[model samples]
Target: MNTSDDDLLDRAFLALADPARRRIIARLSRGPATVNELAEPFAISKQAVSKHIQVLEQAQLVTRSRDAQRRPVHLDPARLEALTAWIDRYRLVREEQFRNLDAVLSEQAASRGRQTKDPS
Candidate 1:
């Protein structure tokens, strides 16, 4: 990945490191919500929730939209997709490695069975 992609992943992961921020993301994933709504489920102050939202905004994981008199925070699916894609890349590689190992072990077992049957 390029430097910019690395930086974006760094910020996104850092922002998601906080439980509060992650909760906020989870909430927004359902739909857009104002800061007050987002703060309702947490014990933290509204200001604290707003701060978490700010961090998410900085990370480009969320964005705010003007709707009438309310500014609701919305989750950015594109950024989340990017993160998922990055993770899946590594996951796919590991899965392939495991499959290869399984095949090798199965072949070895079959070879051992044939050797035993041959009584050699």
Candidate 2:
């Protein structure tokens, strides 16, 4: 990946590292919510929830849109999809490696069995 992509992933992972921010993202996943609504489930102050939202905004994980007097935070599905795709790439590679290893081990076992049967 290029430097910009690396930076984005860095920011996004850092933003998601916080439990409160993760919770905020989870809530936003269902739909958009105003800051007050996002703050409702948390014991933290609304300001704290706002700060968490700011982190998510910086990471490009969420966007806020003006809705009359309110700015509702919306989860950025594209960014989340990018993250998932990145993870899946590595996971697919690892799984393929494991499958190759299993095939090699099976071949070795079959070779040993043939050798024993040949009595040589």
Candidate lDDT scores, in order, read: 0.89, 0.90
**TM-score (C-alpha, index-matched) for candidate 1:** 0.75
Model number with the top TM-score: 2
Query: Could you give candidate 2's per-residue lDDT for residues 36-96 as a string of tens digits?
Result: 9999988989999888998899889999999899999999989989899999999999999
Give all TM-scores, in the order shown.
0.75, 0.80
Which residues of candidate 2, in runs, are more than 4 Å off?
1-3, 106-120
Mark the regions of model 1 whose C-alpha exceeds 4 Å error after superposition.
Answer: 1-3, 67-69, 103-120
Instruction: Evaluate model 1: give its lDDT.
Output: 0.89
Writing each residue's lDDT as its tens digit, candidate 1 over 1-120 gives 244878899989999899999888888889999999999989999999989998888779999999898889999989988889999999999999999999999988877746545565
Clashing pairs in 1: none
Worst 10 residues of 1 by lDDT: 111-120
